[model samples]
Target: MAAKEKLSGNIIQRSAIFLENIGKRFAAGIEELGYVMVLFVECVYWVLTGFRRKQPVRVAAVFKEVREIGVNALLIVSVLCLAVGVMLSIQGIATLKQFGQELWVVDLVAQSVTREFAPLIVGILVAGRSGSAITARIGTMNESQELDALRVIGINPVRHLAAPVLVGMMISVPLLTIVGDFMGIMGSALFTGTEIDMPLDVYIQRTFEALKPDDIHQGLIKASVFAIIIALVGVSNGFQVGSGAEGVGRSTTRSVVLSISCIVVADMIFTYFLNIGTLT
Candidate 1:
């Protein structure tokens, strides 16, 4: 009887520990979310009040962020989207040829690139690249006590650090998405002309016919939201970093993972609403 009782007690103890850990994790996540929201509010407040003498934005920092997050990322975005275009065209051509509807490959590539692939691919790449960089940079500063120094000098760290990144991301990501869209279309056109016996002018005309203004708008909107998510999550993780190089590395990893997860969830929500509207 004593042995059986001990075994039951052990099971209960393990269960309690598991529940406790889960609760702790849940509480931590909630707290982190609250902190991020507060930071976002603080950033918006700073931007809105920037014209007033009470809170002037650092314009130079904003410009620097724009260069870093957008200009520096252009080549990679173009290359990746170009590859996506080629692959998409190849697959689309193969599938449509079976039905003797290969001309519709233009529609497939144009609509898919503008409405879905370009924005999503750009967002994911930015999260992995720029998002991780933001986290590492901020985390390093935190570890080195530079953030504390800023606070000591009466600087609001969020305003000094995060606001520029936020503004830059909001502006740059959509621009990058536009570039990606153009490049992707160009790629498809090139492939169709070189490999599929389609003329360049004909391909271009068909592609434009297949594309709508709404498709471009939706892609830009999604890109903007994704930019916000990447910047916020990256900066938040940076501020949450512990001490040492290890902390910086861990924070960077978390930033990428969290940003991508948030982007995907937001994409799903946007897609669902858009489809619902279309159906109605």
Candidate 2:
């Protein structure tokens, strides 16, 4: 009976050790991911320096990715924005109507959508849609020896692949954010007139009056940062992929997760900094 008890204790100790090791492994993986992101950003910075010379930027490729990612994503953005806007209007009207201030619905809807929901939701959607696609495309190319072929031909993979994607995302995301804000407002207006007693003109006037240029600019800025995060994370995951189908799948998953995490963190940081900047 003593031996059995001792054996059980040892088993528990071993299991604890195994779990600790697993935790360490996860921490290491996360640290490696952070390092990879830093390196990728550094590389992009240097590539942009070369683009300043007016030769390294691939206009055609950047345009192509922009159209594919931004244009293709419009339907989803519009639908989601409209749905959220309608929901926001319903909730805001319900709460504010009690105060006899249903007019405030416009301000609430506009500010919330432009300053918060539009950028964050669009960022998440872009990360999920375009980010995974970027990872898979680059990973498949790497696995197919295409990247190596580019290298052999004396072309820089970072410039050819990463640059265009990063540039495209940077351009596309801000535009999408603006579109989302508009769609959200439209939806909110629809809800206001149909469901609530608020006049459309009053809602529009309130929205325009409540929204400052800084609000719109801040939203675009957040979207831009999120765009960079998504592109960088996606490309880094692609570059890190090993040689197999499983590797592509893993990279795709990592890209989406990392991009979304970065977007959230960056958005928080941007908001804090913007407030600080305004205060000062």
Candidate 3:
């Protein structure tokens, strides 16, 4: 009887511990969400008001961020989009040929790349690259007490650090998405012209015919939203970093993971609502 009672007690203890951990995680997530929202609002406010202040808009900082976030990422974005385009054409050609509708591959590649793949691929890549870099940079500053020094000097860290990043990302991500879209389409064109024996001009004309203004607009909008999410998550993680190098590393990893997850969720929401009006 005593052994059975002890077993029951052990089970209950384990259950309690599991529940406690879950509750803690839930609370932390809620707190982090609140922090991100507040920071986003504050950064927007600063951007709107910064011009009227003594400092005005930080053009130099914005330029630096643009260089770091956008220009640095161009080559990788091009390569990935090109690869995706080639793969899409190959698969699309194989499947459409089975139906004797190989010409439809043009429409498939163009529409899919423009409307879905390019923006999403760029967003995920930026989240992994620039997002983690932002988090690590700020976390290291936090660890080294540089943020505290700024506070001591009466500088608003959010205004000084985050506003420029937000603006830079907003500008850069959409432009990068445009580049990615072009690269993806070019990749499909290359494959079709060589392997499928389609003429270059004919392929280009078909692709242009298959694309719509709304498709491009929707992709740009999604890219902007993803940029905001990545910047907010990255800056938030940076501010929340703990006391050491380990804390910086942890925050960087979390920033990348969270930014990517949020980008996907936001993309789905945007796609659903944007398509809902046409659902008839």
Which residues of candidate 1, in runs, are more than 4 Å off?
A: none
Full-model lDDT for every candidate: 0.92, 0.89, 0.92
- Candidate 3 contains a number of clashing pairs equal to 0
Error of 3 at 247 (Å): 1.0
Model 2 global lDDT (CA atoms, 0 to 1): 0.89
Tens-digit lDDT track of model 3 for 6-121: 99999999999999999999999899889989999999988888788874558898889999999999999999999999999999999999999988889998888887899999
TM-score, predicted candidate 2 vs. hidden true structure = 0.87
TM-score of each: 0.96, 0.87, 0.96
Prediction-by-prediction clash tally: 0, 0, 0
Q: Give candidate 3 misplaced runs (Cα > 4 Å).
A: 278-280
Residue 134's lDDT within candidate 3 is 95
Worst-scoring 10-residue span by lDDT in model 2? 46-55
lDDT, model 3: 0.92
Mind sharing the TM-score for model 1? 0.96
